[model samples]
Target: MIRFQLEESDREVGRFWIGFLHAFRTIFPGFGQRFLAGIVDHHQQPAPTTIAQLTNELEQKNWELILENSSLISSENWWSGFVEWLQPFKEKHSIVFLEDSGKMMRKAGEELIHGISPKLRIALTASEIWWPRWFSEEFPGENCTELWHKLRVANNIKDFSSEIILPKRNLLTSLQNQLRREDQELLIQQIRSMINWLQDQGEWLEAVRLMQNNKDFEQAGEILQDKVEDWSSSGADPLEVLFWLKELPGVLLTSKPVLCLSAAQAANKLGFNFQVSYFISAAENNLYALQHFSRNDKLWREMVLDESGTTVQGILAQITQIRIGENHETEF
Candidate 1:
């Protein structure tokens, strides 16, 4: 089969011609070759036989069939047939019919929204109606644009804060109430999947923020703990990690000595001497509490005490020496 090996600029035109030719063929079978022959110089080769051949010749020759045959291409019968052919083959061909016929797509989406139940409409519009690239420029309505902006801001850390977070949180809660029971469950599953994907991509802050937004505090804490462990083991940058640890709920932060030690190590790396002392003190206190109250908890002991049996006090001494400008390396 003939192919165009289309460039980025040519892809939309290519899809349009391919779709148009298929529509033309459906309307006038056995005449495609003759049409192709008439459109270009055919002295050396016989008229192209297949739709692919016709599309390739037209594109290679730089013939603008879409504009040349605009009337025929846009005629009601032809356009309908083109859409019908496009719907099934678009995915296979990597065709987004919307790029060429966005007005029609928008109209159809609006009509679909009108016909669906409110719950389904919200779910469908949020999940599918707005194309990713066109969200800011071509989004259909003001409300949609605002909602999309809020969603975007919610994911971003720089834009996230207590005052800004509350509005987005309330907006999300409002939208959640409009979704059906099953759709609500599906939305949660999708958010969870997105969180897992973010974590896999090493976007721990973004993942934790999403969990916190959804009120999954326990899961968020678990992710924070995992992030600390990852940094401790892999020697990753700890500045941002320490900041997040400082923001954790007081009760949660104080309950885990390993977390405090991780924060202390992070503070030490960033040259925050006061923070280093504070975190080390907190870790010492939490270690004592764990030893007295939960002696059976070997996991905390294993994490807090190094394999060399270095205690919290030893780690503190090492941090003190480093803070005093002593050229000594410290490990947590």
Candidate 2:
């Protein structure tokens, strides 16, 4: 059995455990704690040395993970996985790692967006899509490079911002202070509009859809702040952005980072910021709910495989195998 770790660099919080094995792929090559075998799962009370044990542990940890996620997950829930209610498992395996990775990644993405802006980070994600590293090899390309410049700008902004977060206190202070009154005001407008747009989960979904189109993201975000200020009056929410520095309630709440703040710190090193962070944050924060769409994402893999004109087995092999040259991918 091969012990594969999510090499530290490849683990982006927003993209992390969010969606592991797709629903359609759930049973393949085996799942649950089965990734860890005998040494971890042999006993009546097996230790988590293998995937089966890992699954059992994941189940126990899922609840706790959700509890931890309560910060974003919140204490209340209108609906839980209805399937779990109908039939419970003999051993516990959780969707929590996916949740943790999802939430954490969202947070990371949002934080990155604050500086990098989620738009740019996303471009980078797209640019790297077919790269041997992350893509499962079979994945087709969307060729969204037209917005490459826009995305690159956002990533550059984030890179510069990360530099602001250096060990030197003076640099942080200078950057913090230099983020002038005008910039702060612009931030307020951005947050307000985003919060307004993100009112419900559906609108949020549409926005996310828009993000997938490189043209949409670069245009929407690149011009967003500046455009809003172009029309707004002076003195709307003077203290809004400053409020976020301290993680203030309500005011900063709307100021969601394009990438998630939770996972932001981790991605600070990604040479490029992918903008999927904000949406990631929304799901993790539970500020947005996951609505069931008419089309099941489970079928996404099938559609992808169909495009590749290969059996699922072939596609599976394509996705699981790492691509070369793409950073973070373990070359075989």
Candidate 3:
């Protein structure tokens, strides 16, 4: 006898399987009646003998139905009035149900895992690349995030497997272009998470470029801050930094000065000589309050002078104008 108890969490998988069975009955004449009877009779007794008898009967002829039902069930959503009837066979029939269902069930993984035995859950998840499609269709904002965490633990996956599961870069670019304004942050976070999971150092630069090309400047700034030292110290293409700086939000200059400084340095490296002073002038022009700005004056001075053979004299005039304008408004 399959020693298992139906859990509340398994309700979705249970419903899908039961629905599949309900559909299965309509196609095969006598099989439905016997399947229904087995469920009812086995439930009333709740004993090992009844379960064994039902299992034996089904095991003998069920494989034939399972093979046929495999294709038939994909087109139907027939779970009703037979959930209890199929209770005794849940564990015994789980694999046949999942195997036959294919990607059709990929969208229902959260519910599906609950209805199966723990061991079966582990087996399905441990098989690499099995859960990614399901996850892509049902995760991040669908309230199935916990299920992803669970599957990761079960499968021994140490990090989020974006490289394995994420759609290609071009697809991501298209999605970004079509995504609504309010959902931009969601896309940013997803891409940011992918960037963090990357193992190859060289790929980080490419990933940053992709984010910039997709116009995810906020995320691009994040990646720049994360890897700016490596790229700068290694003499990577400073034009990449200049490119991001061109698109980056002015508001981020005050809020994230390190990124601003990095962009300025990258621009300076490429002999865009005035970017450091330009950056400071732009920040003062756009930002009224630098109270929360965290970058120190010393770092700002260093970034302004480093290799550019330039000074912050022009930026200082812009800064004085901003302060005078703000003070005049206060007096008014």
lDDT digits (tens) for residues 16-89 of candidate 3 = 33344444446544443333322211112223453455456565454323322233233333333333455665
Candidate 1 structure quality by residue, lDDT tens digits, 1-332: 22222112112232344334545455445434433322211111223354455545444332211222233234434346545644544433444322232234333334333443453344332321123322222324435444435445444112334222222222322344457666766566556655675576576777776675565766776667755666566866565566456445546665665566677677667666556666667767866665664446454444445333545555555556645652344433
* Model 2 C-alpha lDDT per residue in residues 1-332, reported as the tens digit of each score: 11112221112222122223222124333343233212110112223243344445435433321212212222223113312331353244332322232333343334433454333233233321212212212222532233223334433212224111111121222234335444655544443344334434234322432332222343333223222232223432312211111121222322433212322222222211331233234323432222132155444333321222433333334222311222354343
Q: Quantify how close model 1 is to the true structure by its C-alpha RMSD in Å.
A: 23.6
RMSD of each: 23.6, 21.8, 25.0
lDDT of 3: 0.43
lDDT of candidates 1 onward, in order: 0.47, 0.28, 0.43
Give the least accurate 10-residue stretch of model 3, judged by summed lDDT. Answer: 1-10
Off by over 4 Å in 3: 1-193, 199-202, 206-216, 253-255, 283-332
TM-score of each: 0.39, 0.19, 0.30
Better of 1 and 3 by TM-score: 1
- Superior by TM-score: candidate 2 or candidate 3: 3
